[model samples]
Target: MERLHHHKVLTTVTWLLSIIISIYYTFEKPHDGVWPRRKIWHQNDKFHTAFRLNSIIASIYWIVLFVLQGGYIAHLFSGTVEHVNAACSVGSHFIVNNLFHFAFVMLFVRSYFGWAELFIILNFFNLSSLYFRHPGYARFIHTPVVSGPLAWTFIAIYWNGAIMVPHPDTLVARIFGNIFIWSILVYGLFFIVVYKDYTMGFNLSVLSAAIGVSQFLRQVVAFQWIFAFVIMAVLFVATLVVAVPAATGRDIKFARARAGDTERAPLLGEN
Candidate 1:
């Protein structure tokens, strides 16, 4: 109990510090620079085709799971027979409700923090405590987040290299742009070396690659529901024949009605 209280107090302090740092970075002068213009993967038609296809594959992957999940939910209501539909709905969940999670995570990291933020916030508390412990440690905290790697990311990603060129007319703009491009590579290398979180790291890398392609190629956003639906329809049929991962599962407690009726429930089964 005491340990839990200690953790809660420390958590509160970290959150306070993160909020302060986040606000400062938000309105502060834009120090982020842009990568120089170059041939990115998006410039090639092959890449767009691939991305579209992935989106289609991922979308179909979600849709199938959605319908199946609904049916599974219905099955769960049946006390005797627990019909399971073990399809994975992760792809759908991501592109729909979780789409905002991705954008807010990378674009405005403070809003989308998860385990990453917890680590960063803890650093904030440790540094703050350290500063208080020392008599003359205030000076170093001019940039408090620099006290740790996780917190340093806010500065590294935002202050070091920008996604867009801030000032095209200025003389130093070109210099900054060149620096920004190189800095991104350096940052990615640093992250890969330090943090081995494949899922988050891989997703961010893909996002960077996509940004590079779209920015360079001047890709326009177009609404193509029909195109997506067509791709989904095709994949749905293929899913029946192909061995794919199960989409989901659930648990429902029930009282026994008779003897010799023992059946273990599967996690991915639905109504």
Candidate 2:
């Protein structure tokens, strides 16, 4: 019990520290002369014109989702509301971390890359703790959010690069790999526009590949593999459905159109 309290305290402190760092980076002005104007301006303009818009929308969506769904979960587990709330809080952490990452990416893609990569490593450690110390909490929290279609969207994006890498040794494998890779990359690119980083996007792709390979080995090593694959396929399709519309909405044309004719305004009183 004492150990659990200590763990919780540690996690809370880490989360607070991360939040502070994220805020600092978001508002901090770039060091003078640290970056060339062309690159920085280009990225900054892109962020202001496109990526920031998408990220704001996505963040709003997740905020609404967490409130509604999290409330429902809380009601269902009324007897263990504290436990459920804790788990839900963890899920919120996941969303917030991604949001911060997107914000960073919008400001500076290169810096975002390194920071996002470090966050992914940190998440692995976080997951380990949830998996072992609070199995029920972890299962309840992750199964619904992380293992579901929404979660898979993130996974697909992460593994996209690996899938795209050619494997001509086997035609069947090649075809499957291409499909998986393309699906992930295309979908991921959409969210990448909104989130402004490729870290979660890349990690999702990696997770997909790992799951695929694991399922394949299970088939050869055990008879129950077929059932597992079938379930995975259903979940994958569901994830596709949930993610595709959002991905399509992020297209440049769609964004520009939705943004309306603000760009047509006269520059420097030329009109």
Candidate 3:
């Protein structure tokens, strides 16, 4: 009981600290006279590629992601036995994630792109570890808390790398960008097809659409935006076709197993 209580306390404290630090850096002016963290993309627009997401889309997505996290927080304190145990089981993972996330934001806002990329990459691995560790976590709780960030950070690896390199927008760069953009499609589908991770597929699809819109607004005649939009469509369709059926099958099997167990159990008189 003491251990569980400690886990809950630690998780809540870490989450609060992360939120405070992230909000302050992202929105408020710092003593260093640097632009607020949220403005980094606009301030560094010269380094942006066709993969950049629209600010509006990015804003809405984070808002929704935070809301989902809020739901998980509620679950952590729900007072139900199952909820408490679930929260404790995953508390450590969330603590590590929050620390890495805020640290990444700090480095990123300070223009330490190389170090920022390293932190984000580390967070990516952390999230992947969580995903494989708890593959059966309820989607409603797990999707936003884990899978959402995982998908974003997976693509962010490429996005951050691009900014860190700060290359010229040359013909070759655009050509390679167009080719590599499809890798996001492949990444999203692998999870959806192999693991039936619809949450990842959905999050990646939304992100891809956001990138497409941003790119289209940037260059109306570019191949990157068109390919991005296509990727979004494919990911969304793949989730519907692959994950939906697999989930339905799993639920059906679970119901049948429960029925079988009930039938095989001995009655009180027999015992």
Candidate 4:
């Protein structure tokens, strides 16, 4: 019990500190000559590919994600058996994620794309391990807190790669960028189809919109934004279809008199 208390406290403090550092970097200069993150992103407009996300939309998405993270933190202290077990299972991940995020921000703003990519990759594996270790596959809170960041970072790998190489608005680079943009759709669909997770789909859709908006704003006569909008539409429709069950015109939970069998059986068996 004492150990659990310490773990929760550690995670909470790490979360708070990470958020503070992130906000500080967002608005203030990291040092004497370093520009704020937004400025760096804008100043490097030439380096941006078709995959670059809109800063404003991305900021809104981050705000929503962090809010969901706070909910996850509160769940840890709920003291219920399920909550406690969940905290014990994956609580350490929160701390690792915070640390990696802090490092990534620092490295990214300082123009250390290689090291920043390394941290993002490490964070990806950290979150992946947490997902596998915890039994809650697509549980409500777990989806956003765990899967959300995972999906974002998966896209970040590509986005960071593009910037690192300074994809100079060349035909070859633009062609590859257009082709690679759909990878986000593939990644989001895999989880939505396999795990019945809409949060991943929703998050990725928002990202796609951000990308589309950014591309359109930057290059109005390009195919990249069109592809992004198409991807967004497909993901949004898919998420809606998968999330809400069709009207079966019946309540199936108690359809069987002996629904609670000694050996568990799949719901709605073939008649």
Off by over 4 Å in 3: 33-38, 43-46, 242-271
lDDT (tens digit, per residue) of candidate 3 on 14-87: 77777787667656534563534444455335465756777677668877887787787777678675555555
Which tens-of-lDDT digit does each residue in 1-271 have in candidate 2? Answer: 4654554454444444544543444455445434331232233333211011122323343344344444434433445544534544455444444444344333343434344444444544444443333322332344333322243334423322222234322456534443444454455455344433232243344344344444454235432233334433544554455445445654221121112332121111110
Off by over 4 Å in 4: 32-46, 133-140, 246-271
Worst 10 residues of 3 by lDDT: 262-271
Give residue 235's lDDT in candidate 4 (0 to 100): 91
Lowest-lDDT window of 10 residues in candidate 4? 262-271
Residue-wise C-alpha lDDT for candidate 1, range 1-271, written one tens digit per residue = 4653443344334434433443444345223434221211111222232122232222233343334334433332334332211111111221222222223223333222233343434433443343233212111111121122222332224322232223342446534433444443444344333322122223223333433443334334422222223333333333322212222111222222233322222111222
- Which digits, one per residue and each the tens of the lDDT, describe model 4 over residues 166-249? 544678888999899989889889866765566678888998998899999988999999999998998999887765552242
Clashing pairs in 4: none
RMSD of each: 18.2, 19.1, 6.5, 5.1
Instruction: Show model 1 residue runs off by greater than 4 Å.
Output: 12-171, 190-200, 203-271
